[model samples]
Target chain A: MNHLDEKDIRKLTEETVKQLGSSATPELVENVVKEAIDRIQYKAGSHVIDTSPLKKAALQQSGNRIIVTAFGKNRVGILAGLTGILARHKCNILDLTQKLLQEFFTIMILVDINESPVDFDTIKTDVTRVGEELDLKVVIQHEEIFNAMHRV
Target chain B: MPIAIEEILETIRMTEVEHFDIRTVTMGISLKDCCSDDLNKLKKNIYEKIMRVAAEHVMVAKKIESDYGISIANKRIAVTPISLIADAYHKEDFIEIAQTLDKAAHELGIDFLGGFSALVQKGATPGEQNMMHAVPDALASTQHICSSVNVATTKAGINMDAVKLMGEVIKQTAQLTGDKDAIGCAKLVVFANVPEDNPFIAGAFHGVSEPDVVINVGISGPGVILRTIREIPDTLDISTLSDHIRRMAFKITRAGEYLGKKVAEMQNVQFGIVDISLAPTPVPGDSVADILKAIGLEDVGAAGTTAALALLNDSVKRGGMMASSYVGGMSGAFIPVSEDEGMIRAAERGNISIEKLEAMTSVCSVGLDMIAIPGKTSAEIISGIIADECAIGISNNKTTAVRIIPVPGKDVGESVNYGGLLGMAPIMGCSQLSNNIFINRGGRFPAPVKGINN
Candidate 1:
């Protein structure tokens, strides 16, 4: 059975015919048919809100998750130096993003310290010291605060 | 899935630009076991017990902040009301206990330690009276100690004797700490039906029913709420405005619940309530009065101020009640004149008066908080003010407090700056007429008929 329901398949088939006219026979149009199936499958699967409690439980059980942020004049090796210290401390970088506007550079890293052997205090101290050494402003905070302020 | 980049930036922007942060993480420690006939033993016991919790509470709070990239503004402690804890002591003079608490707080790096308190709603005990007497010297002598006296409760009615005493205590506190803009009085709050788990300073204390140790979170975000309203179309009326506020409050409260419970577990203490009050800071853009203004009031004490406060208070409670199961403390919109920008501006412009503030407090979270009054204001008038606030709390069967500091040398229009969370407040003088005869009639104000719903 196809991953998509009958209505989607019918609409997709009609589009295929409209695009290729008589050349869109099922046997000759294998590539188009496969493409349609894949598209339908992806649409059906994507954007489903994860309502599972297990995911939430796992997230919290992973001990501490913090955001490491650095702001400074755009300079080379900022990310490399920061991540190098994090890697040495065995911290897992879960997510990161950066923006460079004129001479200013800003970066935020979401890190999981549950896997890291270092305590939360030492990780913060080291990250802060390293960032300062590179002449960057740094701050660390927990993840739940963001979830609280933004998500209802 | 994962938190969106927009959400991350929004959080950072709130802390960086809007002054969004946790106002306080107050650990309510019970001093029930620290009682002794010997003052030295009592002090030693308190020192040890407080030492065990203070460093650890601050450590965990700092750790949580680092892991979250948010700041915990104040790390504090609120032990069991000093009067109750000192009941076993033979001495009526409890100043030593207050000094000990102040010392412990300083050594622990805690900002303020509440519970220099006496609950005399029904009547004052000899010991409680002595503790109350020590309030002025304690407040004058100590930096970290916060004092309070519950002069009324809905069930027990208002204790006029204690009210009369507090008038004198406030004046003495003002006189003693006159050099510091009467900062001593800022550290003392007079209350009716005060909450046990309030994490905010000047009024926080561990109630008798609370656990041995617990962490209560007061989540602050007046700026965030204001930003939410501004982002929407201006044509939106009160109904939709309330809906938006309620939703935002729910999310803000959830964050507090998550943090409070997790931090409590990590610290091996019982998790306390999440106070969902939109606590305004002195910092611009973070005032609860600004929230009222964004809700379409000309200012916090405008014509529709009380109605606006009622709406904001009710909406916040509706959202916060659903977000956390244990929503306790002063969970509404706070409108302290000094602490709120809109309030300070309105007050300074003479657009808001003491009468208007009193009326608004009937609807807001706390009552007449951080209000600076004239230094020469009589103790009778101070008692009169306390009586009025207590009446509101008793009649409504809700919590209300009076934290009026009569800055010793500053009269009306002249402001006082206590700095930090204790913001600058212009002096709002009270009625010059005497309320001495009424206040001197020392007796309980009987509880209202509505006080007995249960």
Candidate 2:
């Protein structure tokens, strides 16, 4: 009962087709079917689903997520220096983006540190030291603040 | 990215360059249960209660500040007004309790501990009167303790007797701390319709109805708003500019609410409201006056200053209401002459006067805040000023207060530098015009018609 079988997938697909009607396409059908199955599994396991975006963001809070931003005068070794520290600390870089504005280089990384052996303060100190060596402005803040300010 | 690059950069800029930070994370601990008939026992109960409950407040606030990479400027504590719990004691006993509170605050590593206060909007009991009388010594002898007396409210009108007493109290406090240019007066506030959960000092106190312990936060970011207004085109209309301010206020309020709740959770206390006051520091670009100037004023006391401040205050409240479920306290722009560099400059340049500041106060969060007058400005005139401010508060149905300092032996040209967050101000003069006869007729100023809306 915890998992969906073949008949359940067939039934969910039929319901998705009915809901879409004239707007249905192969891509839409496939996406809707996948979403339906995921929802069923999620509800079966968790017993509750968050509908409000603000509450969803709050409920997603944990020790795993953080945001790291670094910006300075464009330099060659900035990325390698930062990434090297993260790799050593076992900090998983979930998403990264870098851009250049005139003479400055701006980089932002979303990191997961739940698997790391070091605590938050130690990681922050290491990152700050590397930033000082490279002469860049770096800050690491918990992800909750960002979600609270911008998501809603 | 889960959070957009523009959003991330905006938050960083607000914190790093724009001077955005949490002004205070004040823990309001109820001490109603600490009351006793014996003065010694009462003092012990009050001291023990504060020390035990707020032991982790500073540590937790520091942790949260680091967690978010945003600075929390002051960690503070407020308690149930001492008069309510220790009314059985004498003025000297209250003074001793103030010392005890000061000691606990020092040990807890907090900047200021508030609630050596009394609420006498209509009248005062013997205990409340004693607490009021102890104001001078309590403030003069203690560094970390703050006190406030509410002499007026919308529904009950102004307590002229209490108002007159506070005038004398302010003078005595000034004289006692005269060596530091009347620094003691800076820690005392006279209020009308004071809020129960105000997280700002020197007016914060836990109200009787509040829970055992709760956390309230006041957010500070006048520089961010000023920069946002500067980026806007000068040709834009006032309404459009107001929308921009409202949006910015929403974001800041959300951040404050989140931080306050987390701090409360860490201490296992109930979360209180977010006070969306744009409190300013002496930093060059972080003045509320600069925001007013960015709104097209020639200077702070220019012709349309009042109108501009009204728009700024109203838009901030509107945006804050939409962002948080619980929004209270004085949620508007604070225009303290000593604390804001632009306001201090305007006073030094003689572009702003006390009368103009009073007019501006009718539309802002606080009234006549941190204004320093000359030494010999008579107590009757101070009473008169307090009465006029209370009248504005009563008729307008809003919170208003006076934190005036009559700096001893100082004239208009000299400025007293208290340094740090207290800032500095040129001694502003008040009219010596005699209101002696009117103030001498000391009685309750009747409630205004606006107070009878219900």
Candidate 3:
């Protein structure tokens, strides 16, 4: 509940004016002080008491999941190739998205690797090989799998 | 009160603009327990322990990457130095360990497995000698195994005997893997004052003092910084530009700190450093040179580029330090030749040279990374580059390493494509003047005056 006093606000305004110099308008100084106070409040626990429906809704979506990353050149049947591979491996592609950079393509496929018979290495090698055949580069990895392995 | 839609949109935009995400969440696991006089058992123990420990890495990395929508460039393992684990084993035993590590990394789906290393900064132990002897063959035969040899330190000084031996080791490693374009050398690095818990490899290793399990994160966002600088108005003064860079760095570091702490908490391990180096990729949009250009340079490696890099590196450290308690590793700009498209382009366009790159390393982090030299460049010249870079690190009291590729059948101006993360680089010329006389002196360079603290 502690907020910046009028004197503290005035001091911050002066500091802003000094920093901004010729560009500092009264309105600009006021805005800067307001933003600073909001940031301070957020850091100082004012924003922690979330009673909103949106907050409750957001908290519900948190859970453990898997991610599959694909990177390589954009080519004909890139997505089809990936889909076929995933289907053949019996990997349930939960959510899929792709981005095109220049002529290259990066696809991210979320899947349940635990239920899938295909291991990550096989998937990676197969995908990379498929990408190679298609003249693209590909990489597949699972989320937090590395940390879980070595980070005792 | 409910947040407005506009406010929510603004928050999303800010998050996206900041590129707030974890770059790498590396786990360092010790393998000392796997060591034994029985070579087969030692190799088996090493492989089993590594595979058991690293089995979950890919899954966890993928999960984290998805939850955060950030690309975790790699999931890697750094083990106890093989010398420590192979103390009783012979040279072939060390090679077996390397092959074992390569196999485990391959099977576990990890990108690179590091700590195929020897720490002989003062002098080589019996085990260290064996590991060093096995490096060429080990590196040549492995696919994902990475190796490092720390032959010097600030306190220990440069071990010239080890350096001399490493020069020949480099030659042998290059010669052994000549058919693979000396890809083995790409997996090798030599260093001074190397950090033990570095999350990046082939450099990462678990320090002796570190806990059994710990999470270290390396955050890279040259693209974000480059994009921000590109938005800067041309009329802004240098100070203003610096301020803008500082602000962007603050946001980037804060993101790294947030994710690092979260991951450590989840993993129930101590949170290690957040490496603030702007690690670049071969991707065109992710070029570090583009960052220089965004900061007002016409091209990277051009005039004023070194000074600009110094400023950028310093400001990043300043902001990152303010944002996180644990900030370490090569916390500066990275100028990897093959890994950075802009640097590669600069080298191709003849805007950057080996000498200028060396000068730039006096300010940047990780000197001379993935630089391809001509096949004809002597082992002496390669050693000379390593010596020069190590001197810079030892003098300045920082971590600097060299990973130079002596590309076969390639000369200055010709490009060698390494594909993937290794990228591509145009071979840069080296000096003809041989430093063999000085190099063959084979004596430790005394520690700097500043290092003589009682």
Best lDDT goes to which candidate? 2
TM-score of each: 0.85, 0.91, 0.75
- CAPRI rating of model 3: incorrect
- Which fraction of the native contacts appears in each prediction? 0.63, 0.61, 0.00
Error of 2 at B422 (Å): 0.9
Q: How does each model score on lDDT?
A: 0.84, 0.91, 0.74
lDDT of 2 by residue, B314-415 (tens): 988888899999998888899999999999999999999999999988999989999999999988899999999999999899989999999999989998
Q: Candidate 3 at A77: error in angstroms?
A: 30
Candidate 3 per-residue lDDT over residues A22-129, each given as its tens digit = 998878977776677666656767754332322222223333334545566667898888788777877665456677869867666655555567666666667668
User: TM-score of the A chain in candidate 2?
Assistant: 0.61
Residues B1-454 of candidate 1 have per-residue lDDT tens digits of 2566677766677778877788888899998998888888989999999998666888888777766766788888999998997875433357778888888998888889999988899997778888888889989889899998999999999999999999999999999999998999889999998887898888999999998999999989898888988888889988998899888788778777877787788888899999999999888899887888888877666799889889989998998998989999888888888988778898898888999889988887789899999999989999999999999998888888999998887899799987888888999978889888999999878988887778
Order the numbered candidates by lDDT, best leading.
2, 1, 3
Model 2 misplaced regions, further than 4 Å:
A1-63
TM-score of 2: 0.91
Q: A56-109, model 2: which lDDT tens digit per residue? A: 332343557788999999887998999899989999776688999999999998
